[model samples]
Target: MKTGGVLLQQKTKKNINITIRNLTISDITHQYCNWLNDKETNKYLESRFTEWNMQSLLDYYHQKNKSELMLAIIEDDTGTHVGNVKVSAIDKNHHRAEIGIIIGDKNLWGKGIATTAIGIVAEYCFDVLDIHKLTAGAYAENLASINAFISNGFIVEGQRKEHVLTPSGWSDVVLLGKIKSQE
Candidate 1:
């Protein structure tokens, strides 16, 4: 049972298409990294991950090793990869893992792109994987992410001061968690 649990935690072959696909080498060569490296995108996570080069993105993808899968977010109707999401650090034993998402289509901001994607992915994480909980953190400055997480039923677990560093300096981080109800 333990070994089975470990295997389940590492499973990553499932590629869910629909506003999200596993990135390809072309994405980096064509400047998909630019979208990811933008400050607006980084506002919630790394302050300057723009350091990642094309080869680095490629190598990182190759090195991911089934521990997690990173998917490219694309519009279902247009097939344009506008964002990305990752369901990683899967712990079948603890039945929890972190969830991260981003919608880079600046024009689509505040239009519910994120809200819908959250529902899609959360359903997969909780319903399909039977994972008991999902967790996420957003920089205190990123109200959009905070609202989306809250709207999706993620409970505010806590806050950490100076948890994120930006070019301007340190910022707070809001921790959130969603545990599946036994009901």
Candidate 2:
């Protein structure tokens, strides 16, 4: 657990050798920028509505916010950066945060990496950060994300009617959340 400096915490899954660590300046690469620009990848993301550029990415990486934690998902075997997971909008007083994940590697989609990372981050939120609950929202049509959250113990808490406007028209957003187990 690298708790000080830029790194917050580290987690590695033995089954897939996938590691999650604090996102650093060095991790801001062209591939990541491309992911943000890729329509297919960003279709369901709110950021898809914005144009992405190197400068914007640099600014994003440099921005400081105490209430959010962004992490990079790495494939330990090949040293490949696969995706990102973010726990943001943290309300420390309320012990809660909003979580989101983006697995940029299309090849790695459908794998259980997102689920594993979500579980690890949720545990970190509860056991390390002392957060009481975690929340996430996904487009109603994003079954993969919904399934990943559910498989990681999140439950559908509610739905926002036509929360987002897509090219296909308005789409609902499913709200999901999980509370730290009182053990």
TM-score of every prediction relative to native: 0.82, 0.91
Candidate that would win on TM-score = 2
* Best lDDT among the predictions, by candidate number: 2
**lDDT agreement of model 2 with the native:** 0.84
Clashing pairs in 2: none
Q: How does candidate 1 fare on TM-score? A: 0.82
Query: How does residue 54 of candidate 1 score in lDDT?
Result: 75
**What's the number of clashes in each of the models?**
4, 0
Query: What is residue 160's positional error in candidate 2, in angstroms?
Result: 0.5
> What lDDT does each candidate get?
0.69, 0.84
Q: Where does candidate 2 stray beyond 4 Å?
A: 1-14, 64-66
Q: Write the per-residue lDDT of candidate 2 for residues 56-149, one digit (tens) a residue.
A: 8878777733346888889878989899998887886788888999999999887688888888888888888888999999999999999999
List runs of model 1 lying over 4 Å from the truth: 1-18, 21-29
Tell me, what's the RMSD of every candidate? 6.2, 2.8
